[model samples]
Target: MATFEATAEAAAKNLESGRTLRELSDLFTPMAIRVAITLRIAQKIDAGRLTAEALAADTATDADVLERVLLHLVTIGVLTRNDRGEFGLTRIGEDMLVENGKAANPPWLDLNTVAGRAELAFTRLLDVARTGEVAYSAQYGTSFWDDLTRDPSSGTDFDVVMAGGMERRIREIAEAYDWGALGSVVDVGGGNGTLLTGLLHAHPRLRGTVLDRHAEPALRTFEDVGLGERATATTGSFLDPLPPGAGGYILSRIQSDWNDADVRTILSHCLEAARPHGKVIVVDEFATEEGVRCDSEDDLRMLVYYGGKERTMEQVRALAADVGLSVESLRKAADWTVMELAPAEN
Candidate 1:
């Protein structure tokens, strides 16, 4: 049994710390917000659905439960309630109104999309820890790629998600290297040809190809962007043979999504395709232990989602060496590191 003074002292310290009962272990808050996003509560409120009844009617949810959720959101600073029982969004809530009415947050956090659905695999993280395999298959009964292949719409949604904010990065990458000198480049595993399109646009003399699992979208994008003459799309996987003899074989932001062995295989394929004279240009970020630390939540996401990882610079060099390729040039372009690899001389 503790004395009153000791109890009082501990209580005072807890209060001074301003810690919630379970702030460090809170689970309900995230799911609640996800539920709100799925229901499009913010959009409804933005459209003048001020009361719980109105929002519930719009979302086809029970009014009483929804009112409780709305109040919880108010406590969490996502919303506010007026004296007259009307609800309104706070500034934080406004960020949830996705551009073009698509998602309140990134598609991964929207809960209404496939990316969001895939994120739920994190719930099976313990299984991932024990098996050292991706949890996505355990959670969804199919691999992530297979899931996408089964549903074309979900695959398109994923491509859109990947293309988010890539425009600025593409412009920066295009200017970083003398693409015109390459004459021709292949965007290996390129989705929708966003990067290749930008490169073609930046360097009028450059010809490019988009190689991916789907050809139609990239073909349509190239035609839509009026680069049809300079760009072509082909259906293929990076795990298979790539088109040969291009001046540059680009694996833009691709290596991080594969394990080391798979990365080595991909690099070997690129080296074979780009042999003798061509360069293999890889665009990705490194996980550094020192300085400004490029490590992020994405590091863990790569692991749990796909059995992939964010590798350190040293790991990247080792992977390159394993495939008999040497990094000829390495530079930072936008948020990604561009590494130009060449086959090691005999």
Candidate 2:
């Protein structure tokens, strides 16, 4: 009876504490992390300046305020405060150091940069939620894609973020599928040829082509990977006809940026290019039905930034059918779903 009473008391305390409100208030944590990253706090700490005063002196911030922030970070497991008033990076905080490469210096999290500005537009989520319109354009006075195109530096940053972050995922994709039988493949909208380079590097017998709006970089990547002879990079839109007769065509994480009509159009182009027995491989996140959200914030990000969506498997199959392709198989590689399609029978 005493144990039951204790359990009941704990449950009541949990309910009284308002977990929902706590979670909602935690949104400020990302901004705090952004600020810390911007000030190179982790790097400063790693460089032997362990006290808040030293960190503030190096970062040109107020010592008292910085100490508060550091204290908050310590509570969040990002830093540890010792009895000597020295602070050190926790495992999570270590990733914020610039020396850690992609993991340490994620371009999107650098609040001073364009990607960070884009992320900040999420504060207008209420406006997007009410209007079913993009918050990015409303916040920034221009569409996300337009802003990227207009600002070369920002665009380059965005590209680096996408390419650098997906290295492990690219390796998983390269190894997940059976590329042995495919003689030739075209990577539609292949950004910087990262995926194609991985694929070609893994399968020596296969030749590949990357169709992207930016061809020079893709070509350079092909050369870097030593697949220059076996791979070709062409500048083109995937909405138009692809290079015909490839054994396999790939649309890796491209469909999530467009609406249903655009997705169908891209798939139709792939269908036109794919030989009768050729395969069309789409790599994207699949929404689960059990109300267990995966990448839910990403879906919101897509909606607010590009008016696109992360779709469910059923929706994807329907879209494939509309484009005259039939779902042949599905494979899971990390958090992404690789949906294989073939020409639909009349």
Candidate 3:
């Protein structure tokens, strides 16, 4: 009886400690990730077992700094220490860094790359929460989209990162949703249109318009993916107005960048653009009946970098309802929900 009590109390303590530990872990996060990523540490190990010193020398980074980052990552299960001070990839590290591992996940680490640097701007998150404004704008002196527009390399990397995500997200959608009934679809905030390309491939008859700020890259991606004839890139802000009409709409990974009020504005944009008899599918992160289960580090990471959050399905339903869109079906797919809304079909 006494042992059972002790075990129960320990479980409770672990719950609390686990949450706190998660946030503490966030301190190293994308910086450490990008650090190793920038150095191509995992790639180094793929060749063979190697010492941190040799690895550092080869990568042109200070051995001490690389050692510290590797040790911490090992603590978190991202790297492994071999005999003789050599280093190697842990399963997690391999998933993130191995060549031929994932095509969509690589350019994500180019620190000089737009999305990579933008992700590492943890300090700028404070301004976003404090002022309820765009975090990148105040810190970098321009909007996230604007910075990409000015620099070619940054812009290309950023678009590749987004398109990479689209590669995965589109797979989830095309597999999960019935595509035959839709005549025309709009990918709101679609950049470079690769996701649309994936979706269009699944549904040959469906025409698509990409609503975003810059249409050039998306237009090119569409053409490259062989969806040029059916896909049109329309440059505009979903914040100001979404283009007139569409049978189906996609907002994949679009929300969670703003607080509640801003999300409402985005919802309103979706509402305005959606066809009366149509469906607007929002692909995003959400908590569900299973539980609020993201690791503390991931929670804090999202908080710091994006000034946004993950939400419960109830929260999403409440927000969608408030903006005159009714949740038709919420398909739980891994970490994200494919939410189908139909302007309160009544």
Give per-residue CA lDDT, model 3, range 121-231, as digits (tens).
Answer: 666666666866555555566656676777866676656655654556667777777665778888888877877888788888889988877888888877777766798
**Which lDDT tens digits does candidate 1 get at residues 233-279?**
99988898788999999997788888898999899999999988999
Off by over 4 Å in 3: 1-110, 124-135, 163-169, 289-298, 331-336
Q: Name the lDDT value of residue 122 in candidate 3.
A: 60
Query: Tens-digit lDDT track for model 2 on 268-303?
Result: 899888857799999876776544444567787777
Quality of model 1 by C-alpha lDDT: 0.83
Rank the candidate models, highest lDDT first. Answer: 1, 2, 3
Alpha carbon lDDT at 3, candidate 3: 44
**Model 1 bad stretches (over 4 Å):** 1-21, 100-104, 289-293
Per-model C-alpha RMSD: 6.7, 6.1, 6.3
Q: Model 1 Cα displacement at 94 (Å)?
A: 1.9
Worst 10 residues of 2 by lDDT: 98-107
Query: How much lDDT does each candidate structure score?
Result: 0.83, 0.80, 0.72
